[model samples]
Structures are given as structure tokens and as C-alpha cells.
Target: MQIQDLLKRTDKLPNVPDVVRELIQLLNDPNAKYSDIAARVSHDQTISLKVLRIVNSAYFGLARKISSIDEATVLLGMDRLKTLVIASGFASSVTKVDGIDLPEFWTESFRVAELSQWFAKRTESVDADEAFTIGIVHNIGRLLLHLTAPDVAHDIQTRVSNRQASRFKAEQDLLGFTSQDAGKALMDMWHFPKALGFAVQQHKRPFADGDPDPLACVLNLACYLNACIRTEREIDLVREGLPMAVIEAAGLSPSIVYELDDAMAVSDGLGHLIH
Candidate 1:
């Protein structure tokens, strides 16, 4: 029931693509140029093609097609396009799990990621792309469980539904780890920058240490808002679930969150993911 037990279950982890690993390093480097990242992205034809497709597609709503990685870099900026590359490349690398619906999972991830970026930019609390990355990867542990421990994962989902148990509590009670634990272990395995890994670990209790990790807090709110959006709930329901520290950290009021309704919609963008 320890993290070690979960880690020992090899099927639970996503294979972080070489493309994603290199991009993470470049993003962490203060001196890394846009050209450098562009070059790295172009090294993987699948990712490069996927990014170009998304950029040129209606999702980005550009005036003209993005013909190459260089052009994509210029139009989308380094961070935003890089976030897309990472999301697409990582999605490409993960094999289909027996039970989880990857398309829905990815759609939700991207939705939350985009919302996180918008909110982060609003507050200037963290980099938009960093927030985006954290949001997309936050629930990765759920995938890990679906792959490596299907029965337990399904049972937890059932309990969360039938018994009104929360996902975290159900996971903790049945398997001795929450999705947060699995997320932390997965991100740690991928060797991302600390804040990205930390967000995965601390997002469920973003100010548990009495100080907010701005990105985690933003992601915390993003996940809540995503659920609200998916369920067609009112903004008040979302506000009720949000932590006060997260609201302060993101410089967001309930009114502002309410105002963000349109920007957070994902039905159009989910169509752009590579098949």
C-alpha cells in the first residue's frame, strides 16, 4: 500500500517521451532560445506535425497556416506552442489503458490547462504555460491506476459514485494512495522541474505548508472549475469548493470566475487533438 508498492507496479507509469524530456530541460533554462526549443520540437516528426496541425486548425484561428516549426514558434510564441507539443507528444506516448477513456481524459486535461493559463495570466501569479502544463498533467495518477490496478481503480470510482465518497478518500482507503500520490510519483519519474512535480503533489492541498505554490493553487482552482463546467453547474457551486488561499493566490474573485465561462469551454478545441 506504500508508494513503493505502487511504483513497483510498472504498468502504472507513462513513458515520458524523449521529446517531452528535452523540452522540459529547455523550458527550465533561462538562456534557452525560442529557436532552440523550435529545433528540438522539429526533431520529432510526429510532434512537429501534430503541433502544426493544431496551430493551423481552427483551434488557434490563425490567418494563415503554420507551415513549419519555425513558423509555429513565431506565431504561437515559445511557451504556448511548447505546451501544445508537450501535451500532444506525451499523449502520443501513452498506450491505451484497458478502462479509462483517453479521449475524454485528454479533452478534460486540455480544457483545464487552457483555463489555468488564462487565470494565471489574469493574476500574474505564475507563467501561463507553466500553469497549463501543471493542469494537463495533474490527474495523471488516475491513468496510472487505471493501467496498473484496474480493479481497485474501478472499485474506487464505483464507491465515489454509489457511496458519495470523494475520489481521494476512496483511493486512500482502498489502495493506500490518492491520485495525488500517483501524480507525484509519475511526475517525479519524468524528472520535470520542481514546481511541476510539486503541483502534482500539493495541488489537492495547495497551501498545506502555509504558503501557496502559485501554479498549484491555480491548478487546484482549474480542476474545480473544470468539473463545474462539465456538470453544467452554476458558478456559485464552483466557488463553494474553492479554497480561500487559492482565490487569493490567483487574484480571482467569484465574479471573475463567472466571467470566464466562455473562455473555459472545450468542445471546439478537443476536436483538434491528433488521431
Candidate 2:
């Protein structure tokens, strides 16, 4: 459960393939050409098929069916196409864990992604697709923990269920680190953008002064809203001190937040989109 243990387990960490990594890099580039991006996506037939499937799925709400990677790129745009690829890669990669139920994990991930997209669209601070990707991968540290230290992962889950401790608090007590910390470390090593790495690292403590990036604040709000929807428990100390300043900055209200959660829960055919 120590940071050193996680560092040692890096070799065993699930990684996106080289092609997928290249695709991600292209997506992250601001000036990457559409034809070049399409070419990269089309090279991997499996990923190309998945891209087409997601584009035609309810998640995109496209008026026409997408039969090719080029058409999908045209319909979804570069950023959204990138997000879908990232989500598809992760979803396909983490289908099973020794101690984790894949379905339950994906259910929560889908909900979080949907809610994050909703909030992002409402706020306009970041793209909804980017928010969806962030929400889906925000807890990837938990997936990594299950692989590296199954016992510790079980202990953390038990505390969340029995003691009602927040997942972050539980991780801190049991593992001397939280999932956000682990996720940040892992993504940083993977060469993710600094803004995303910072968001994953500080999502639980969004309001702490001098956190320069506002995307972290948006991620924190998304996590809070996800937790609120999944559990009926009243807002505790952890929920109360979140960056309302950031929430206001994002142009969101408590009511709009609740509506987003509701819409995510009933997003038609969304259950089929995860796997």
C-alpha cells in the first residue's frame, strides 16, 4: 500500500498499447489534422470498429449510422472521437480483475462519465467529452490498487461500506495514500497532460489555495456529484468544504447538478456503451 509498492508495480500496471498511445498523443495535439487522425484510427481495425459502434450508440446521439472511422471522426469531431477512443481502450482493458466485479465498477464509471459530461456541457469550462474521459479514468487508481494489493483494496471497500468513510479517507488510513494520489502518479508516469494529472491528484481537495488549474476544480465537483447520486447519505464534512467558488465559476447550481445526475441514470442504451 505504500507509494514504493505502487512504484514497484509499474511494470505490472495495465497499459494502453503503443498504437493506442500514439492515437492518444495525436488527440491531445491541438493542430493534429483530421485525415491523419482518421488514418491512425483506421489502422487498428478493432479500435476502428469500437469507434464506429460508439458513434452510432446513444452516447453520441447521431442522426445517421456511422459505418467508417472517417465518418465517425466527422460526426464526433476530434476531441469527442479522442474521448471515445480513450474510454473504449480503458473499458476493454479492465474487463476483469482478480478481486473486482467488472460490471459494478463499469456501472459506476458510466454514471460518473455521464454526469461529468453533463456538467461540462452546462459549465462550458471544458468539453463534455473531455469531462467524460476524466470522470471515467479518475478512479483508475482503484483498478490499479486491486491489481497490486487486493487485500488493501478490499479493506478500503469495507471501510466505505461499514464506516461510511469516503474512499479517499479510507485509502489514506489504510494505504498511506489515496487513489487520487496513485492515479496522479500513474498518469504522470504515462506522460498525460499536466492539467489532467493535476486534476486526478487534487480532485478530492479542490479548494486548497494555489491549485492553479481550474480543471481540477471541475473534476472535484464532478466526483462530488457522482458520490451524491450513488448514495443517499447527507452531505458530510467532505462534501461541504468543496470549492463552491469553483462551482460558481463553472456556472453550475445544486439543482442543475441533481438534474445531470438524474439524466445520467436514465441515459438510454448507455449500459451497452461501456463494454
Using lDDT, give the best candidate's number. 1
Which residue runs does candidate 2 get wrong by more than 4 Å? Answer: 26-28, 57-65, 209-212, 232-243, 249-271
Q: How do all models score by TM-score?
A: 0.89, 0.81
lDDT of 1 by residue, 125-210 (tens): 68777887787788888887887788888899899889769887898899877888887887777778877888888888877777
What clash count goes with each model?
Answer: 0, 0
Which candidate should be chosen as best, given TM-score against the real structure? Answer: 1
TM-score of 1: 0.89
Q: TM-score of model 2 relative to the true fold?
A: 0.81
Compared with the true structure, the alpha-carbon lDDT of candidate 2 equals: 0.70
The lowest-lDDT stretch of 10 consecutive residues in candidate 2 is 261-270
Q: What is the lDDT of every predicted structure here?
A: 0.77, 0.70
How far in Å is the alpha carbon of 249 misplaced in model 1?
A: 3.3
Worst 10 residues of 1 by lDDT: 266-275
